[model samples]
Target chain A: MQQDAARLKVTREGDIVQVEFTSRKILDEGNIAEIGDQLSVLVEAEHRPRLIISFAGVDHLSSAALGTLITINNKVKNRDGQLRLCNISPQIYEVFLITKLNTLFHIYPTVKEALESLRSGSQAGRLK
Target chain B: MKHLKLQAGPRGQRQSREKSVGLWCTEEFPSEMSEGRRVEEKILSQCRKHAYGQRDLFALKLALEEAISNAIRHGNKCTPGKNVRVKYRITRQRVDVMVEDEGHGFDPAVLPDPTADENLQRTCGRGVLLMRAYMNNVVFSPAGNSVTLTKFNESSSSSDTPLSTTTVAFG
Candidate 1:
């Protein structure tokens, strides 16, 4: 599988790009770094990057993955862009909850909601 | 005496709600991420064989990843020739894993609170927090070069409830 070397499946809806994981786990440092670099290029290309990362089928993620997301969030915010995370599994959600990252991130239950909110700058469907 | 008793049963042999010994193995691997992944798979495979629930498998996997990464990165500092030692015992009721690195250790207490408001945008310092959250118990060596993670399978036995998560540091 040529895709064994790839970690993300990225798509675009106009300026808002959607990112998905090709693997079930995000525990490796090298893979996380590559994912970070790929997303960074997308964020830099836009004046105000609108990014949605959907963790639809991901099962395991580590603190290193969290750190990379934080870095991405910072990059987006610096350009006054918006970043949305969606479809996180309940177990992975607990990781965000335990780290209190839920409060810092704009998390939605689905890509539809994240798109809706990002389009209108609405704070709807955010995790409480 | 206890060893003789544990050897008397099959895999996932149950003894009591509080504790019992099961299949175990110890091995050392070079300080590399791929080796870390190999050990993680080996341990998780045993957990699956013992019929551990998905939840327990997830927790154990996460804790193992964090602990091993810390040993390779923080403890060993990616030093050449340094090795990571892993020891694990898996039972139907619970799993205990210990990971030790060859380099000098660092104090965990002085670590900054990653969940603090000021640290919200920071990229790290959350691995230890997750290990404590998901595992029933986390104990670090006195030198802090090694950590032991314990997780009780929720589906093991109705009476074998997991104790409150706690971190014990050797003084």
Candidate 2:
């Protein structure tokens, strides 16, 4: 796929895949669907996908986006994979908290921290 | 001029406050996410004109997008040729928005709480929950084809429950 058409910037490091959002707002239904598909493909390709999705530069997101994240989490779990999320803005973090989704997803403050947890198998997540 | 009333005030319970002049707009768009974006931008532009803070804008943006998308997907079944109608009024204190779809309405009362442990992992069903959380008032029409959302600018989140379930006028 062309770089401009890609909704995520994905790279692999050993068993870990670091993903970054290309769109600031993950609210658009089309974009959310595409993001879900892309992530699904990546997760399915691995025996046990270790993925970290960074929310850096994301401004606004809707519940639809949250639903997409939930879908990704389920897929990773079904395959016995690990998923970590990091770099969430305060406003966006509040969305997760309001819906009580902060408990469901492994969220961290920085990509380094998320990468560490994915590697250490001691993932702890909460909004600070 | 269309007029609508809410049983509960911005601060929750029915209270009397000085009414202020407001700017209002009513529009219709095709059942497409792009059209939904147009509606969102139009409304957010209005909110910005009235000096709505970033926090208020974020809440409104989230609620409006969810409401519009629900109407398009769930209500219209993602079929083309159908339309979503939006009407909102912005005042100094608050903004009230209504979204209606052409499809038959369903009861809004039976929606499962997405926060439940079992439902937490569900891929859908969180739209209405977020709308209720961010907006001070969220009401459905008697027929359930429409939703009315209200948010008070620069106001803290409300602890008041909805005055009445499915209590909005949609014509």
Candidate 3:
């Protein structure tokens, strides 16, 4: 399943779907809502259960984005699916640490690593 | 409550040739999310003009967004006719931002902790946490209708000054 939005680009690589945020800053309220809607659509579609959200181009993320992520994570988990995040910048990384969200989701330093781990069936330490 | 008096320059350097630059802007927007975001962008543009570093800029930007959004969504209840008031002061060393909504305020102490085990998965309640985490000081009026956030520029030499003793009122 592939989807596109003004600020997000989604493509599926086998069972692992990758959603890349193209915006430099994801702090705008309208943009945040649109991104959330797109992700929710993906979750409801149920085409590919596994997801990897790439934040390579994102420079800033507000609490609204964090909330959206939590909503999407819960949606995926409810269906026995997995959600992973990769390429989070140091600034955003600090926020995850502050909120202790670093422990709630599987975060990887690179997209390749996240995809590899999910494909290898390494679910022991990868969840949360 | 620690009152921040708006000072014109670096503390205790009033005689120095390097004077402080102060900027004040107040804007009123309808209780719409997009309008709140526009105000946040405008404030961030001004902060960048004052030469805020990348990390500090990002932090302030996030905090401001959360504050303004809360004022519009929660305080104003997104009522079409209701408006949110945003007032901000930018100095060489710090930025003071205040957001007020035209509604009854709620107590901040009653808010649930988003970081707790039971609340960890909650989609909301994290905005206040983010604001407190990123800003130097976060204060609410007795009525809770207004919130003030202060963030000191880490790269500025005057950032070491004590915040409680240097309070100055702005016109």
- List the global CA lDDT of all models: 0.83, 0.82, 0.82
Q: Say which docking band candidate 3 falls in.
A: medium
Write down the RMSD of all candidates, one decimal each.
Answer: 5.9, 6.3, 4.3
- What is the TM-score (0 to 1) of candidate 1? 0.87
Best by lDDT: 1
- The residue ranges of model 1 lying beyond 4 angstroms of the native Cα positions read A1-5, A26-30, B1-19, B159-171
| Model 3, runs deviating above 4 Å | A1-6, A123-128, B1-13, B16-23, B157-171
Model 2 residue pairs with clashes: none
DockQ score of candidate 2?
0.72
lDDT of 1 by residue, B43-131 (tens): 99998998889998888888898999899888888776899999999877678999999988878899899999998888988999989
Residue B122 in candidate 3, Cα distance off native in Å:
0.6
Kindly list the per-residue Cα lDDT of model 1 for residues A1-128, writing each as its tens digit.
11222667778887888888887765355478878887788788889999999999888888898998989999999999999999998988999999999999999999999999999989988996
Local error of candidate 1 at residue B104 (angstroms): 1.5
On lDDT, the stronger of 1 and 2 is 1
Whose DockQ is greatest here? 3
What C-alpha lDDT, on a 0 to 100 scale, does residue B13 get in candidate 3? 45
Q: Per-candidate TM-score, first chain only?
A: 0.90, 0.90, 0.88
Q: What is the lDDT ranking, best to worst?
A: 1, 2, 3
The DockQ of predicted model 3 stands at: 0.74
